[model samples]
Structure formats: C-alpha cells, structure tokens
Target: MADEPVLPTLPKTPFNGLGSKRAWAQANAPPPPSVSTSSDPAVFSSDDDPALEAYESARRHKRRYVGTWYDQHLALSSDSVMGDDGSSTIVGSSPVVYRPQRRAKGAVRQQKRQFRKLDSGVYMGGQDSTDTEGDVPSPYTPKYFVSPAQLRVSPRSLPQVSEAESAARDKIKNCVEYGNQEVDLSGLGLNSISAETIAPIADIAPIPLVVKGVSFEQADPDIKVYLYNNHLKDFPLSLVNIEPLTFLTLRNNDLTEIPTCIGKLKNLKTLNLAQNKLKYLPAEIRRLMGDGGKLVMLHTASNPWWTAEKLSFQAVIEQSDPNPLIRTPVEFLDSNGQIYSRFRLPLSDADLAESTSSLELEVEHPSELEMPKEVSYAEGDHVRLLNPTGARSLFEYALKALTKLPEPELEEVDYWLGVDEGYPKGLRETLNLAADAHRSGGLTCSVCGRGMVVPLTRWVEFHKTAGTIRVDRESLVPFLKVGCSWKCVPARQVVPECEEKLPESDD
Candidate 1:
C-alpha cells in the first residue's frame, strides 16, 4: 500500500495491419557478428575434420527429406525430372530428385503399414514404408506328431475256449494230479460240465495206472462233490456214475429241473437243493426220503413253491352263514383245496345289500358258466402217462379188479381169469404173476385211501413242512391244495408213518 507502483506501458505502432508486428520484429532485430579467420575455439573449427563433414552431410539430408508440401509437389510433378535442355535428368542417390507416382482421378491413396512378428506370436511395429515383395518368408511349415499303427487280430484265429472252461479244466487237472477226494467246484459260474471234464472223477475207485512212467494211485472210494452257487440248469447225469459218492451239494444254482436218474445215487447221504429256480420236483424224490431212504440231510429251502388260486370276496361272502350269532363265515374250500376266506370278515346285512345292488345280476355270460371240459395238461404239469384217456386192456382191467379182492383170495388166484386167452402159456403165466404182484403191492388212492392197481386220479401239491433253519419276515410257506372235483374235500392232515419222521442220521 505504499504509493501505487508505476507500470511500464508497451510501445505502440502507427501501422496496425496483420503483418505489421512481424515486420517491426525483423527491423528491430540485433545485427549479425562479423566473420573472422582466427583460430578461436568458440568461433571457428577445422574444415578438413571427418566428423565435421559427416555432421554437415547428415544435416543436409534431414533438411532435404523434411521439405514443405509445396517443395514435394514440385518435385513429384512428373514421372521424370526435365532439365533446361529439355532432356530427362537421371535420378541419383538423393531422394528429392525422384518423381512420385500419380494417382488416378477420384482415387484414394492408402498408406502401407509394415509389421514385424515376434517369437511370442505378436505384431510389434506400426504402419511403415517397408516393401513386402518377392521374399515370401518360406511359407511357415506347421509341425505335428503321428503315432505308429497297431497290430489287429481276428477272434477266429484264436482257440475257442471260454474263461469258465479254462478254469474247469484247471480244476479237473489238479484233482487228477493230487488225487483229491472232495472236488469243490463252487462259484465257478459254470453253465455246463462236459462229460470229459467229469468222467475221470466219476469212478468209484480208480485203479492204479502208469501214465508217462508216473504211477497214479487210486482215488478215495467215498469221494464228495460240491457244485454250489453255479449256473446249472439241469442235473449233471455224469455225476450218476460216481457210485460211491456219499455227499453232494448243489445249493444256490439256477437248476430248473433235476433228472429222475438222480434217484440212482443210492449212497448219497447229504443233498442241498436250496435257493434254486425249481418250480416242482419229480415224484421220485420220495425215494430219497423216509426211513428206508439213503439221504439223511436234505435241504430244500428258499424255493418258489407255487401259490393257490385266489377266491373272490363275493364268493366268500356268499358262502358265509346268514346267522348273526355265528359272527364269522364257515370254512370254505376253493379249487386249490385251500381256505383263504378265513381272513375276511362276514359282511353285515346292510353291507351285503349294498354290495349286491352294485352287481349286474340280470345278465349272465354263458361262456363263464360253461367251464372248459376237454382237460389239457397245464403249464408245469409233469405228465407220467402219455395217454391220459387210453382205455385199459382186459388184462389191466383184470389186474385192477384183483386189487379189491382179499389177500388170501388174491393169492389163491395166481392167473388172470379170462384176460389171458391168446397169449402163450409162459407169457400167460408171466401176466398172471404180474397180476398177482400188482394185487399184492398196489398203490393206494390219495383221496379215499383205497387200494388201486391203477390210480384214477393223480395230482402233485407242495405241502408246508417244518425246517431246521430259521428265516426272517412273515414268510408264507403255504402248502396250498386245489381240488377240481365238485365234492370239495379239503386235504387231510394225515402224514404216513414212513414220511412222518426224518431218517436217523448216521452221524
């Protein structure tokens, strides 16, 4: 605040045109210094120095390339430069004397850009004037790897042997070489056992024989065989040849049917047929049971024993007693000779009326009422007689009639009465003897317990029996019975003395 400072003002010019400031600056500039030939370091340098000449040459080249647009236009006016003598001037190493290419009218000029590729698959440079011409970079060849071919073989060229068969062969070889008494072939998944594989071990007691100078001892008389948990569909008949075999087990297999010849195994003491797909067994199986039978241990658990036919609720309720005091329906029998109506309660009068109203009573199908009479063997029925409807011959009739006679009278009549007319005396005597034998050892009827030379009716049924083993769940070991006869008689609980008890074990 001490007295306002006086500011210096800019000098003014009389001319105020656009170039007035530029002209004033040129006129007021400082004068150039005068040249001198003295060897002063700041003012002069040696003219003959190579470094000085190179620097001058570089400065002249930079000036020539950086010419203004007007200079470049004049230099590129024609394809060749014309001299004062009207002759073309040849271009030298100087770039300014060369004429530029002329573009067609309305054509655009594109700047060529040069790019350098690095080892890292990247472009590193911007647009430049580098020419990419006749040198084509040797067409970059890509590299890859190829694998060698593998050998192929056909299945027909190899031996036709399965893994199971190979294993079975190995087992048989070991048994023969070591004289094994017990041949355990369990869980080998064998679908079948060839005769050749089972024949050597099937002998009762093989004799000592010399093979390849090696004497082989006889096998044990009481050989055992175990074929459990396999894929056997039928009993191996080859095993029947093992006369002295005492123990045989075939548990947990896919056996659908066993051969009747299995009864020929008179010495077999233990047998296991559990957890198989057997729907029913042959009647000859009885020969393996009872007191006189050989089998002491018989396992038949976990089989899918067939179930009885189901009875409708209407049939059960209709057969029920109408009396209110009874409180339950009477025991009713079905075609299967079983009583399944015991579990259902007797319907009340009101409920019975309601159910009856819903039933179509006016219409009755004739086809339903008329049952099929031409009896044909059902599925799973194992027929013993080929001709179920064949008429009996006179000799067979006479033999059947003799079954009704008393034992003393039947013994007295040793020959057929009138049925042996045209046969020879020896044949007649043989027939007469057969008739007497049939009368003496005739089968009894299953229904009425009457002695029969030829049974009029026969059926197979699975009956429930107690087992030594315990099982989980409320399993229905149902021994259902079915009777097609009009007189419905349920199966009696009558166990014959022979089959009532299991045979005494030798152990």
Candidate 2:
C-alpha cells in the first residue's frame, strides 16, 4: 500500500474509431478519384480536394499511409507506439520498393558431323584410306591361266644306243664262267642279239651250252647246242661236228627230215624226235646196227611217219632181225607177215623171189610137200606139177574114182560089185593079182582082220587095210603091170602117218 500507482489516461483521436492498424490506414488514406466523362453523371473529383488527390497518387504507387494527420493522431493516443528513427525499417513500412529473382542459365549445344569417299566410287572412313591404285584385292589370281603359245614349244630328246652296244652290255652282265675253263650261255639275256655276235662267243670255247626262247638263226654253230622252246625249221649237216654227243632231243620242232650223218654218232644211246613232221625214214638209219648191235632205244612217236598208210615198218623189221633193245607200242601190229620182233629191215628182191618159188612147189604136190595152209602162197589153187610118176598119178586117180562112185550101204556089196564088173580087163586082172598078194602078205582088215579084198565090199573097208598092203617089187607089179582096182585110203586112217611124212591135205 504505500504510494499506490496511478494509471495514465488515454487520449481520443480521429483514428480512435478504427479497430486495427490496417483499418486505421484505410480510414485516414484518401479515397480513390472517380472517372468522369461528358456522358457520365457528375461525381466527386480530386481537383475539388487536394489532400485526396495526393493520397490517391501515393496509393497508385503502392505507398503506405504515413501523412502528418496520421502521426498527430497516433501521438494523442498513448496505446499507439513509435520506434527510434535511426534503426532498420520493417519490410511493410514502405510499399513502393520491389525485389526480383534471377532466371537459371541454359545448357550448352553440340555441332553436326561430315564424311569423305574414294575415287573408285567406294565410300571409306578416314582411318581406312591408302595411297596405291592397285591396293584393292581380288578374289582370284589372273596369272595362273595357260596361253596357246606356251603349249607349242618343242621338247629335247636323248640319243638312242646301237645294237652292238646293247649286245656288249648284256654279255658283260649275264655271262658266267664255269670251272674257269668254259663260259655257260644258259639264261644269258641275248634277246635281240645277232648271229654274228653269238658266233664269236661260241668259237672262243667249245663247251656244252643251253639256248632257250631264241631262234636258231640267232645261234652260233660252234657251240654245243641244246635247244628248247625254239623255232627251228631245218638243221644243217654241219651240226654233226659236235662229236662224242650221247643224247639228242629235237622234240616239238619243225624238222621234216633227219640228216644221214646221224648214224655216224656211235656214242648216241637214246634219240627222241617226238612231235616232228617226218613222213618216212631214211636208209642211213640201218647202219646204226653197230658191232654186237649197240643201238639201245629210239622214241619216234607223234611223228607223221608212224601213222602214214601203206608204207609199213613191219617189212623192214622182219629183214633186219633186230636184237631185243628196241620197243614198239602195243598198238602196232605186223599184219603183212614181215616184221618179227624189233628191227625194221626191208626184204631184198632175191629173198622174195626164192620164197615165191618154194610156195609154188608146195601147192603143186600138196600131199607130197608139207606146207601151212594158213600161209598164203604166190600160186593159188591152180598149180602145175613136173614129172608126175605112176605112184603119184595112181594116188590122185584113186581119190577121183572113189569120189565118183555111188554111196554104198553098210549091209550089202551091191554098188561096189557093180563098179568092179564095169572095170577094164587090165584093172580086173590087176585087182585079182593085188587081192592074191594082199592075202599072201597077211594083209587083213584093220577092224575085222578077215582076208581083205581089192575093191572091197565098201571103199571104207578097203582104205582101212591099205597101210598093211606093201609097195615092194611084187606090189608095184600088181599096181603098174595092170591097172589096180583098190580104192584110195580113207583120210582118218592115213592122216596121222601121212602128216608125219608129207604136208597136210585139207581133204
């Protein structure tokens, strides 16, 4: 309580009627001036009031209301306050000042690009260009193709050697010396060698040599030759100069004849001339029958001469009388009755004549002379006889008479008795004499032994006793002095004894 505080009294002003500062400003500020025209109604003008004109002008500039009247009014009211004049002014204190923001700077822009092309009308980058015109590559090469002129050039050739040089080279390489004494021509490559070249080599040494698959015209004669698989037509006699040759083979050649000098080789044991063209043998081959007859074997099969007709080897073989050293195949047979065994010797003209004479003698007197009937003779069935004696004539005549008589019966003597009566008186007297001699000489029937009669009952019975009838002086008188009537002997009774003494008779 001491000295109680006294409050100050507030003063009334013209702005006292406003509620806020913004309201106070609006009340004290001058009103806006009206727009006028001739056609418009009469209204309040700023010319009629100067203070309103200044206030309206300030408001257009966005100024605040700070006139002298507003200050005085604020001084009278103690609630209205004012700040020091020298301090920073507030933003709303002056409405005429303005502040603007700056715009941001725009981004920087880029420029357009360009390119170049080559003279060949080909587009290229700056990094790919080069300086040369032929620098552009092709897919294939142009120089590999061949031209027509290059193909026309001629080629060089080597020289050829002569035949002499070829022969010399072949001899040096293929010829071999045997035992340092002789050269062997076997398997020597002499394909195109001439005869002149071969002759000199053969003359140097006379040794055994074999030449195959070459012509004989190309071979030398001085060499001891053995030929195989060769074409030789004819061999000359000069080949025989190879003396002391033991064996020779001319198989499968074209030789048609053998040289006569072949017989001169006494040392030759075997000779083979198979598959040749010979048609006949030479006479010189007969001389090969050496001392003791030393020709051993000869093989001449497959030759044309062996199979030739009419020219037989059998005639020659029979004359030769060969030893057993020679052989012929089983198919060969001496049908001509000439060949005996081995050798082929021909018959001489004289020997054949003598044989003919002997054969004629046998057929003329067949009962007296014995000869083989199987063997054919020069004289056939018709044969002549020389100096046929009574004995011979009677023997033949009796056979003729017996054959002419009629056949007799076994029981009777009718035909025989008739024959005896018709006989001549001389024959009848001889028959009586012959019968007396036969009975006195003890001549009897061979089967019954009763005293046999001349001109017996049957001729067969008379023939049986003829062997006992002797042909002595007495017997011959009966037969020759008077014609005999005794019939001839039967063949069966006389065959055995007659066959021993004379040649056999067919009848």
Instruction: Using TM-score, give the best candidate's number.
Output: 1
Which lDDT tens digits does candidate 1 get at residues 1-507? 679985453344423232211233432323112111111321111122223334333332111234233232221222111110112122111222212223211011111111111012121111110111111121231111000110111222222456775687788677766766678888899887765667877643544556886767654477788899888877776787777778888998888656545656778788887888765554344455534357666667787633222211211111122311101112332212223222222112353234322222221221211111112224443323322234434645665565556654553353333344664445434334445435233343334433334333233333323242222123222222212221122233221232222222212
Q: What TM-score quantifies how close candidate 2 is to the native fold? A: 0.23
lDDT of 2 by residue, 96-122 (tens): 121111100000000000001102212
Error of 2 at 243 (Å): 1.3
Candidate 2 segments whose C-alpha is farther than 4 A from its true place: 1-224, 292-297, 306-507
lDDT of 2 at 192: 31
Q: Backbone clashes in each candidate structure, one number apiece?
A: 3, 7
Q: What TM-score does prediction 1 earn?
A: 0.33
At residue 344, candidate 2 shows an lDDT of 25
Q: Give the TM-scores of the predictions, in the order they appear.
A: 0.33, 0.23
